[model samples]
Target: MVNKILCATRNGIGGEIVQVQANFVRALPAFVITGLANSSIQESKQRIQSALHHIGFHFPALKIAINLAPADLAKSGSHFDLPIALLIALHKKGIDTQEWFAFGELALDGTLTYNDNIYPLLLEIALRHQNAKVILPTSGQELFCHLPHLQIYYASSLQEALQILESPESTPAKTQTTLNFDTIHIGDTDYYYEREFPLDFIEVKGQEIAKRAALIAASGFHNILYEGSPGCGKSMIAKRLRYILPPMSLEEMIESVKLQALSAQKPSYTPLRPFRSPHQSASKSSILGSATQNEAKPGEIALAHQGILFFDELPHFGKEVLESLREPLENNELVVSRVHSKISYPTAFLFVGAQNPCPCGNLLSPSKECRCTPKDISSYKSRLSEPFLDRIDLFVQMQENEQDPKPSLDSATMQQMVFHAFSAQKQRGQSRLNGKLSEREVEEICILDDATQRILLQARERFNLSHRAIQKLKKLSRTIADLDNAKDIAKSHFLEALSYRYIS
Candidate 1:
């Protein structure tokens, strides 16, 4: 009989579960591993043999054929090392199957080592099959101990793992809920990056209009654009906004960690929102998803899912990257298609873009003289298409000022406003925030009274709002109404939403 053990792999955005099966026949004592194993996995034979010898166990002296079954699935990473080795040891030594899903890399000294794949892979398994019995390396035990499902066991060495397999039903000594943030008090914990944004919203002087727009954006996760001169607090306001944005749920925290795992960066288990600011020279492939590479990679937007994506000097970004925003900005997700396969990733993020009115960056500055010709200014503004501009829910133009120390709101005050709106959204049984309302949800939920409809009709005819823009306007109105603590969209709410349209 073939000995089979279970494991998982990081396939795409998530992962796939794999079965490692080993069968031996009376032939030459050769160890062969098959089924699309990548280079790291293919070279595991020597490491496994060395690990067994170091741990006082001998390699199976028979023709051992190790096959990763249902073999068509593409598998990668060194996380498979532990499971493959386990199958060989169990079959060769006449040990009964323990039915454990093992994942970890083996060191030549017979101890388990860390791989970045463990977090994302185990998260996928626990979510799919709760109550799973898993054996992982001790290095990352703290990272996953808070999992409400899976009964996880940590083994520090190959010798210890074999002892666990041989003696089933014995609980491992080192099992604790160290990764305990799953039940963490959201929004109140002293965060990992406590000092990320040093400046408060009150420090942003003489831009109450801009702060008002920021308030609405934070309340509803709305996409916002700021047109301002240099030193006009455009980037400053954008940075502070992340601190005041609403708290993330447990599910949002999990989604954020999984996305970070796909990139070179290690996954952070904090409830703090993501803030990504790609440089102006970054390519469209880097901004949006990339398919030309060997594997499809989730771009910055997907990485910014359930958080904020800020683009500084927005006009300097390429047209392709700007145009690609239409999908994620509206639908809240992106389907990256390759010739071989297609993968969809959730990208529901608040987008914040900042730009100067003219190429000289002094078009709006009161004290600075403008040197750029009218054509230069026109061409720079023309780079942003009307369709792209319409997707934005709020727009504010700012100019450099000497000082206005009188504060409008600090982070604490603004956070209260956001929390109020968030409470209102949830009380109304809304699964999404106001700005993310679908066309169907907007119509069904944001029912305008006769007076509100009159304001909307008058504005629609005067502005010649397109169907898409009108739909977006309703979303904006919904957010404004939520901010006012109103149960319904009144005429004032509709008018305020209309005032934010394409400012001169």
Candidate 2:
């Protein structure tokens, strides 16, 4: 008799279902597994046999052949152990297997174990197969607690799992609580907005212009650059921008959690967007992604999807790493290619770069005298090319110090403005923020007044702006208009957008 069970395996940040088919025939006592499995999967037989032995069940004398279906696809992970063991044990008893999905690693002493990586696979199963049931380890149930309308059966050991399957009707499956998206709080608590952030905007003693630019950048998801002397709060402004940005939608939250779980970290269900700040010494492969012997993994860019990628000390990063971001910044995704494979990952992040004006950090400071030579300054600035600079939406020069240090903004006040701009984008049916809008979408949504159009034309001609730069200006203008709660782009908004263009 042939017994079959459903299983799943990870593929990047997603999951693919596998059919575990077991056949028993009269022959010499032996067992084998086939179908493009990796070393970890091939080693499952030993684990399964040990677990079965501990459960008081000996392997049958007949030859057994287990095959994972879809022979062309690569399958890895120890989660296949449970399904394979279940199929073989039930085949020996002449018990037919149903369509329930099973995933867990079997211990030598018969205990089933799982980790946070199971959450991505679980999410994949829940989304693709709505009516499917699951048999998972009991310890890792928290990952699926918020998922609704799914029937999950939790088992602690191989013996307990078999007993539950034998008398399936007696063991009721655990049901997920219904998540009301419309009514559910986005953050963990109602006081989330009022709580003090670790790096609040109020902490910055001066640089009101920089804070206003930060607010605009957060409101529209714009890529911004801050050039100033040391201790000018450049990094401080970039670090706190993520908190003021709008909350994520339910679907976006699920995607973010799934991506995080791929790294084997316990995923949390919070609407706050991710804020990734990789060290300046990170390698190109670490930021863009690379293929291992068996699988390709997402890099820092993918991890920062739909979030913030703050590059402090921009010139300190490798030239290759800094330039590689150009494609993802334009396309909202990245494709990493290796010798035999290519993997694509979403990288829709708000790019915030902060850097010193020169190596001595006093080229632009009025109070500090620059001791570096002209060639030295040129070399330091040459690390960032003009093409890369053109991608930045806002370029703000922070003040050396506050002549009048009265803070004009705080996190709470700026977040309210961000919410208004976010609502405007949603009202216009835009999935992305204003700064990431396509050229065609900008033309469609940002209706410019005659005076505003005339000013833009003059600026494009006078500045020798590239076609891309013109499009970016229009997007910036649209964001400025959104912040002002205006339906159309006005002359003042166009002027504010033009003032941010990079001069060098």
| Highest-scoring model, lDDT | 2
Candidate 2 error regions (>4 Å): 92-98, 148-151, 167-196
* Alpha-carbon shift of residue 320 in model 2 (angstroms): 1.5
**TM-score quality measure for candidate 2:** 0.91
Cα lDDT tens digits, model 1, 1-504, are: 888888987666777888898998889899999988888889999889898778677665689888886688777888888988888767656765546788889999889987778887888888888777888888976566655578777888887778788875768444333333323232433112222346698788888888899999999998999998898899999999998887666556766777777776787677668999999999887888776323567889988887899999999999988998998888998878877777788888999999998999988778889889999999999889988997898888876884666757888788778877887777777788888889889898778899888877887888888887788788888888988989889889988888888743
lDDT of each: 0.81, 0.81
Error of 1 at 283 (Å): 1.0
In model 1, the clashing pairs are none
Show where candidate 1 strays beyond 4 Å: 92-99, 171-197, 292-294, 402-405
Worst 10 residues of 2 by lDDT: 186-195
User: Candidate 1 lDDT (Cα, whole model)?
Assistant: 0.81
TM-score per candidate, chains pooled: 0.93, 0.91
In candidate 2, which residue pairs clash? none
